[model samples]
Target: MLALPKPVKRAIAGPPVRRDGQQLDLDIQLLLRLLTPRRPQPVPPPEQMRAGQSFVDRVVAGPEEPGVRREDRTVPGAVADLRARLYVPPPGPDVVDGALLVYVHGGGFVAGDLDTHDELCATLAAESGARVLSVDYRLAPEHPFPAAVDDCLAAFAHVTAHPVEFGAAPGRIAVGGDSAGASLALTVARETSRDGADPAGRPVFCLAFFPVTALDGHTRSRELFGDGFLLTGEAIEAMAGWYVPEAMRDDPRLRIAEGDLSGMPPAYVATAGFDPLRDEGEHLVTRMREAGVPATLRRHPDLVHGFATSLGIGVRPRQAVAEAAGALRTAFALLGAT
Candidate 1:
């Protein structure tokens, strides 16, 4: 809805719901119930679906955060120059100056761009007091597989090399995003933190919001929440197919959870209890911790996938983001101290 629907307003104002040991946020439940069609409908072509993504973001995320300052520019990518947006939050005593988040936008690897996640970057910049650079990596089906991965790594390298050019400090660079973007961030972390990697140059922290850690796998969470949840299992597969071929589904880039996790930056992986990717995201935390990385996992039991972007819908989403921001602040402090 471009504006909050009456049903959504009612859901936001009502008490939350308890179901199956997980409390679904009332507003999220209402939105899912209202948006899901009564009968199956043909999935739109990629171009049409991309157009609808912009419209849906405006409707769900509302206006971008008011006080944040935005600048549009281009950043270096491995295969091509990519459009980018830099967000500088309003300065205040609480602001953690020079903290940088190389933010990636997620729309199942095929649909999202910087505009779809505009308010989200602003929210992260404002809440974390970090300068967030939103990357518009080449989408799949057009760019496919390693294009996204290569572009993100190249963007991260550019930001680290010229932090002041983007109004960020050199050592405070962090990588973060939601869903597919998060998957890319984790891959960056994995590559940058390999054995013999320079500790001082690697990402100091990573933030993942309900990351799709595995493209092929069946889990209880997927079976339970695959349908009628904000992100369906079928939808996940369709989007992933655009990014990866059937034979390459076993590649570490797509099946990220099974990859080696040693030497990763301190990480925060948040999962929504009612999300199909919940189990995989949680599994990422265990894998990271087992690898001796200082990683933390926060499960928002009341939320679902995509809640991180709906700042206009309810408070829970913002709260979850705020927590992630706090983690960034702490990581920045540690990085600065070193």
Candidate 2:
């Protein structure tokens, strides 16, 4: 059964035809079900959530079968040595030839880590023909705003500075993440561009997956999907408050889209139809294009935020990963030509 919001229902009432040839609307529909709040069915401890996610990773993500080779490793980044995992496809030669994608996991700046995104990274490595480095940045509510940002920046710097150490071609490196992680990717791109001190004096392309670009809580999507969409306004507010301080919300390094986007690298932005951060992601895309930065925006109307990250479990998860891989491939090709 597909759980849909009133607005989403109304939007799809007239048409049985799928826009992107997707027959089933599992992404958004199931998300609505998950968001519906079912009277708190046996709430468990926070550690249990991690345990459950680990179980999901084991079962759904499973052991590497034939074509994939995964490993856990760490690199020293913005913060103290950050934890990271590397996913490389089989065949040693292809590892060096493939593009490198450094990923940050999304937990709204609070939860999530490399374990949570294990399957997604594997899928990306396989689909995009790119080695994926999943970063476990320091979470918020403990680390706070600049801590997360600094951690991510450090990860980016470490990767971009020493691509060969990670078995990557420095010229073909890209940064991306989901939700808060996505925002970090955008910010890193901005900060990196501002410095104009690249290893070879080239900017890094970015892939932002349903990123929460704005923290001001002023967007329409924020209000619409605030509640009953798996992510409520209160939840977002709490996460924002936990991750960022009121005084530094306007800081360009913290808020990537808040500042000028000129000279930023080419970007591919994804937005979900019913996500609170939908418009913020789109707005950034518009701003990037307006600033003459090569940009591409794609909206999965029948999807919600976090769909890409959760796709490893459901049928639609693979599709979401494929979409992101396609975006990465496209961005790499675009950047390669220039």
TM-scores of all predicted structures = 0.93, 0.83
TM-score of 2: 0.83
- Kindly report the root-mean-square deviation of model 2 from the true structure over all alpha carbons: 5.2
Tens-digit per-residue lDDT, 1-338, candidate 2: 23455556646433332433333354345445444555744433335544654554454453443587777888876647988998886775434364788888887777788877887788788777778899888877778878887888777777777788777876788888888889887887887776545644243678888888777758877876665556567767767777787888777776566667888888888887767888888988988998889988988766666776665434555676688788787666666677
Q: Give a tens-digit lDDT track for model 1, residues 1-338.
A: 42477575655545565655987876777677667788976666678878877777787895568799999989989977999999988978868878889998888888899888999899888888888999989887888888899999898888888888998876789999999999999888888788886665578899999998888868899998988776888888788778887777677766666767877888999999899999999988988888888989999998989887887766788889889988888888777787
Error of 1 at 337 (Å): 3.4
Error of 1 at 115 (Å): 0.8
Instruction: Report the lDDT of model 1 for residue 49.
Output: 71
lDDT at position 74, candidate 1? 97
Off by over 4 Å in 1: 1-18, 196-201
Q: Give candidate 2's whole-model lDDT.
A: 0.72
